[model samples]
Target chain A: MMVPVRCFTCGNVVGEHWEEFDERSNEGDEDPEAVLDELGVDRYCCRRMLVSHTDLVDVVSPYQ
Target chain B: MSEEYDVEFVEREDREARFLVRGVTPAFANGIRRAMVADVPTMAIDTVRFIENSSVMFDEQIALRLGLVPLTTPPEGEFVEDDTVTLSIDVEGPDTAYSGDLVSNDELVQPADENVPIIDLKDGQRLEAEADAVIERGKNHAKHQGGVGVGYRHLQRVEVVDDLPEFEEQESQIVRGVIEEDGELVSTTEFDHDLSKRYPGKEVRLEDVPNAFVFHVETDGSFTIEELVTRAADTIEARATELEDAVQL
Candidate 1:
C-alpha cells in the first residue's frame, strides 16, 4: 500500500527518497528522469521502483 | 609474503565508497567483500506489536514494511546481538505514517531516513504500533544487511601496445572496474567503459596488477562507509582469532 522500503530487484533503499521524488516529479514540474538522477538512483531497477509506484494505500485504505 | 597491505580511497561518501587495497591475495579480497556483506551487524525491526489497525493492509504486511526500514545503527560495542531498541508509531487518518513518526526510546537507534512511508491512513483510519529493533547480521535476514552492495575486482592496468594496422577495423574493447594508467587511477566509466573511446585507433594491453583489488561498497544508510568497512574487517579478524584458539586447544 506504500512505496516499498527497498527496490524489489536490488534491495536498495528507495523508500527513503520517495517523498522528494514525488514532490519534485509529480507535484512539481520536474521530469521524473531528472528527479531520479538528482537522487543518485542510477540503476534501472531502482528507477522503476520509484517510477511505477502507485501509492495505492489511499485507494485501498478507504475500504477498511 | 611479507609485503605490507595498503589501502587508498578512490571515492568516499557517507553511504558509498570505492577504494584500492594492495598486497592482498584474491582470496583475502573476497573474504573482505563477503565479510562486508554478511558479517557486520545492523539494527532492523525484528518484532512488532500492533495497538490498533483500521487500515486495509494486514498486520503482517505492515510489519514487513517496518522491518525493511533501515535504522541508524550505533557504533560497535554499543549494542549486542540480542539487544533491542523500542520504537513506536501512532498516526490518525487523513495522514500518512512515515518512519519519522516512529518515536525511538533510544535516540541513537532511530530510523536512518525520515521520509520512508509506512502506510497511508484514509479518513478515520488509524495505524498504531510498537516495534522492537534488534541487532543482527545479514546472514540472518536480508533486512539487516548494512552493506547493500559490496563487491570488488582486480585492479587492471591498461598499457598502449601499438597503433592499429592501416585500414584495420577498430572494434570496441569494453573494460569494467577501475583501471590504472600512467600512475593515475581512473574509473572505466569515465570513458564509458570503452577502451576504444579512451585510445582511439590504437592497440592497448590490459594487465592485472597482482595482489591489488578495487572495492566498491554501498550501504543502506544504517551506518557510514567508514564504520561498515572497519566493522567488517573487525569481524573477519575476530573469526580468525576464534579459529586460532580452537586449533590451539
Candidate 2:
C-alpha cells in the first residue's frame, strides 16, 4: 500500500524510503525511536515515523 | 488605523465553514503595523479611521471543532495585544449562536400530569458532570493502537439524536453540545456531508456529542434552568418587539 508520509515542518512529501528502511532494520531490538535517535532527529517525531529509506538517504548526497 | 482589523482564514480536515481569525494591537512599527480587535461597526473597510480592536485566535482543531468563521485578512498586520479576543462567529445572523446555548439545560419537558412539578438544580453541577464525562471518554478513546495521549479529542461535541425504538413512545427533540476546557462549544453543523440536508448549517462530531453522557437532567449540562428561562423570556420580548413594529395603527 502507498505510504502516507509528509514533512513535519512544511508537510511536504519526503518518500517511502524511511518506512522501507525502518521495516528492514527493525530486526534485533532497534525500534523507530532508536533509529530516529541514530539519525539525530530531535523530539519524538510522530507516533509512526512515516518515511522511506530513499527519503533519509537524500539528506546527504553522494558527492558530499 | 484604530478600526482596521486584520483577518486570517484557516481551513481544516473533514469540515468546512469553520476558520480562524487572529488580530493585532498598537505596539510596534511606530504604531504603523498595529491592529486592535475592539468592538467597531464594520460598514466599510477604511484605513486610518477604521480598524478592528481586540481579537481572538484559536488553534485549527478548536476553530473547526467549534465551527468558526472564515476571515479573509490576517489579524496580525498590526501588533496584537494581550487581552484582545474575537468571538469567532462565522454564520451570518444577529444572534451569535454560541455553541454553549445549543443544548441548554432547560429541556422542553413534555407536560406530565398536573401533579408532577418541574425540577431544577443548583449552578455549576451540570458543568462539572459534563466535564467529568468528557474526561472519562477521553481516557477510554486514548487507549488506541499507538497509545495517543489525551489531546484535542478530549473536547467532544453536542449531538442531536433521532427517533430510536426505545424513545418512540416519548418523543423529544434533543440538541447536544460539547464543552472544552478552553471554553469552546462543540456540536455538529447542518453542513456535514450527508447530515447537511436536514440540518443545513450545523454539525457536531460523533464522540464529542453530550447526549449519551447526559445521564441525569437535574444536573448534567453547562447552564442552570434559571439562565435558560431568562433566555426564553428574552425570545418572547424579541417577538413582542417584532409584533409592535409590524402592527398597523
Top candidate when judged by TM-score against the true structure: 1
> What C-alpha lDDT does candidate 1 achieve relative to the native structure?
0.90
- The sequence of per-residue lDDT tens digits that candidate 2 reaches over residues A1-64 is 2222323332212222344345545544567656665643323343244533223212332322
Q: How many residue pairs clash in each candidate?
A: 0, 53
Q: What is the DockQ of each candidate?
A: 0.72, 0.01
Segments in model 2 whose C-alpha atoms lie over 4 Å from true places: A1-28, A33-64, B1-249
lDDT of 1 by residue, B55-153 (tens): 878999999999999999998899997899999999998898998899999989999888888888888889999999999998898898988768898
lDDT of each: 0.90, 0.25
User: What is the lDDT for B236 in model 2?
Assistant: 45
The numbered model that scores best in DockQ is 1
Residue-level lDDT of model 1, residues A1-64, one tens digit each, is 6788998766789998888898899889999998999999988999999999877765765465
Give the best candidate by lDDT: 1
Q: How close to the true structure is residue B143 of candidate 2, measured as C-alpha lDDT?
A: 10
